[model samples]
Target: MTGNLHAGALLLAAAPIGRPEDASPRLREALSAAPVVAAEDTRRLRRLAGDLGVAVTGRIVSYYDQNEASRATELLAELLAGRDVLVITDAGMPGVSDPGYRLVREAVAHDVRVTVLPGPSAVTTALVVSGLPTDRFCFEGFPPRKAGERSRRFAALADEPRTMVFFEAPHRLAATLEALAEAFGADRPAAVCRELTKTYEEIRRAPLGALAEWAADGVRGEITLVVGGAPEPAGLSDPADLAAAVADRVAAGTPRKEAITAVAKENGVPKRVVYDAVVAAK
Candidate 1:
């Protein structure tokens, strides 16, 4: 049975990624108060509601990739009719590499109010604990499963400066990590966060090569990989060359110390490298 549509509002709530205790109060209220709830997996939704001690008072319907397009039309009509509909995924925010994008798009086209109750997200959770630079980062939902395609994808981002995050199935983790190491370099730092927020939650930080070796034995859980960005451009191998580059900065009245730091940062090298260059130039 449909509950109150609340002026045809569409609420996008994030379900707990793992631990149900992480579920926010707003999520509980939304689950119990919404007139209609569209879930990527209705069974999982029921389980989550149970864990949160929330009895979903609203009508729950299956909404997933396979049926998202058709479901959007039906859900949109309900929203337009002033029925409050809540859209949630199996985990994390809907429309983020998950279902709910279609409904949100339809809701906007029909001038329906759309809102979000942000909560647990594997992407952000993995990033923060990834030990990788969070200031500049990008999320690449899931890598292409095919070997050649996956290699090409990693090759395309070979020179990416921003830290990168990607989701991968457990069974393919080892092979994917090896490809990443090959394309991004073996020594590139990275983190493998698995089953985040779950009882067996594991976070392993190491060079891509090491991670590849570790996962070779096989893993079992949701996986998120955060890889450090590519190093600075090539051809500045000579310390003398780096020193010379900093010389120009120093000439511009940017103190030697500042010049060295700036040059190293711009070239994505260790500050010590630039500092040693300045010292060696003297």
Candidate 2:
């Protein structure tokens, strides 16, 4: 019953993450009324429509990573024709590490009206349940498959102060945990949310090292990892403070030159500043 249907618009619909009962009435209406429904999986779309007992009168087309570009153009044309097109994914909202982004981007470029029928999102769901700080967080979809690439990915985020969310395959969860522990430090707190909103749901909250060890036994089902952000670096209010830190490292057997460099890097200040402080202390 949305006026945009006849006026031509792009509707991004959110599908239920697990249970069909969670589907909203607006989703049912959108599925039944849109001129065309672009789905990540056509079969899943049909199945979801069936579950909702809503007949999809419009055409259903697959819109996945492989065919997104070509299909997005096609959908944009439909939008230009003044026909509302609804975009949906297998689960959760479209465009969240899903195939709807290209279509949405094209729609915006073409001056097509874009709207969302928001519903379930695995990202927020896992974040709230993660027991980590949620005031600030970032989603790092999926890490690289290669060991070296994954290590680099974690290394880049090692100093990030926002909570981090990630999706990982069951088989690789343990290895990914190990890599995270190594990059972020073993005692960094994190949580593993498995099969969210589904039967056999499990949430394991602990330090990265403990989770790594637990996952070594192998894990199954969908996985969402939430890692606590890096603790804030101590403030260096005074040059004397910098000198004291460098001196501590030096007393721990690090050479004066190396300690100054390390302290400068850690404090994100200039080595010259730290060296000046060290000299002033002497």
Candidate 3:
């Protein structure tokens, strides 16, 4: 219903994260009315359609990660032919750590109209439910698979003030939590949401260290992790305090210049202030 009349529009549909009942009415209509439906998993699409009691009259094609690039071209052709194409993933919105991004990019390149049928989102759902600050937040879809890369990524984000949301596989949950605790400190608050909106939905809120221990036993189902932002350091205005903070980092093998910058950022002070304090302490 939201596409251009002359050229077929690309519709990005958001599927329910868990329950079929959470699917939007617009999505049901799109499934029935679109000329072509590109689904990440054709079998899951059919099952979802059946659950909604709607018969899909459109041509359903597989558009998963393996076939995403090659299939995007075919779907784009359908759009140029004035046939509306609806993209749906296994759960949640398409192009969100899922297939459909390539097609959306191609469609835009060819001047194809694009629209969205928004519904449930695991990112926002997990953020609100986690009781973390919602005013500012970011979604980090998944962490690097390698231990070294993951550690570096977390280190870079250690000073990020906005709440962070992440999606992760069950098998990697324990290791990821442990790495997070190391990077963000064991006392940092976080929440692990599993099987959101499902019958066995669970949310565990605790310090990063405790959650790491809890996940060591293993977990199942989909996972969304929400971690509170780095807390601002308090009452470290004294030059001796700043110098001591830099000295501690230097003793731990961090470069003096880097340590000064880090301490300044962490305490909401200027780099010059920290540098001057370090020099004066010498």
Candidate 4:
């Protein structure tokens, strides 16, 4: 059924990544007022509510990855019934590498109003605190677990020009860092932020190789990784070098015109210069 004027909205709440006090006032109000609270971890939600000195007055249900699909259907029904269903994850915003996506999508499909209670996020927290270029960046979530998949994924991103953020478990941090070092480069600048916004929080900024070595000694707490983007290739002034660069891209199946444009941009030269070089070589 389509939503009516009295239909309830779906609230996607952001939980504090570490400190309970980071919880927003709107979140506290929603916790106490929502007709149904879908939590990634009910136990952890209870603890957070208690720590916030706010008792949740709604029915609490588990809504983690295992039952996300089925639970989304149920929650959508609740919204359709004029009951606000608040979705919260263990930490950070719901549906961010988390379980709220299905419910949000369902609610939208059913014309149920959906909104967000934005607050703390590990992605931005790490990126801002990493001292890296924040003008342009991307969140990669987590790397693939299998060695082959992870290697291929990193290889694909090796030429990415924007700062990158990632979430990773403490247990796999060492191996992941090593793999990133191998794929990106040993000297790539990176930061490993652990237990952010909590006691004993640590931000270790170093080259990928050194961070890999440090993590091998064993680290703890939640982890967020920030890595610098690939450095711009040195500007090519030599016509031979510029022509060769375009030729290499053309050989790799890139269109000649597109290759010339890319080579011009990469080497801080003009398109005319690269075009002339390509023509001169031909």
Query: Candidate 2 at residue 67, lDDT?
Result: 95
lDDT tens digits, residues 1-282, model 1? 243345578999998898899999899999999999999999999999988899998888999999999999999888877889999999999998999888888777666788899998899999999988999999998999999999999999988999999999999999999999999889999999999999999999999999999999999989988999986676565888899988887788888888887787667677887788778889
Selected candidate, larger lDDT, 1 vs 4: 4
Model 2 alpha-carbon miss at residue 276, Å = 6.6
**1 versus 3: better TM-score goes to:** 3
Residue lDDT tens for model 4, 1-282: 556657789999999999998998998998999989999999999999999999899999999999999998898888888999999999999998999988888888878888899999999999999999999999999999998999999999988999999999899999999999999999999999999999999999999999999999899999999999989877898999999999999999999999999999778677999999999998
Per-residue lDDT of 163-245 in model 3, one digit per residue for the tens? Answer: 99999999999999999999999999999999999999999999999999999999999999999998876747999999999
lDDT tens readout by residue for model 2, 145-253: 9999999999999989999999999999999999999999999999999999998999999999999999999999989999999997666848999999998998899
User: At residue 258, what lDDT does model 1 achieve?
Assistant: 84
Q: Please give the CA lDDT of all the candidate structures.
A: 0.90, 0.91, 0.93, 0.93
Candidate 4 local Cα displacement, residue 191, angstroms: 0.3
Q: Give the TM-score of each candidate.
A: 0.81, 0.90, 0.88, 0.86
Q: Candidate 4: misplaced stretches above 4 Å?
A: 1-3, 235-240, 243-282
Residue pairs with clashing backbones, model 4:
none
Question: Which lDDT value does model 1 have at 209?
Answer: 99
**Highest-scoring model, TM-score:** 2
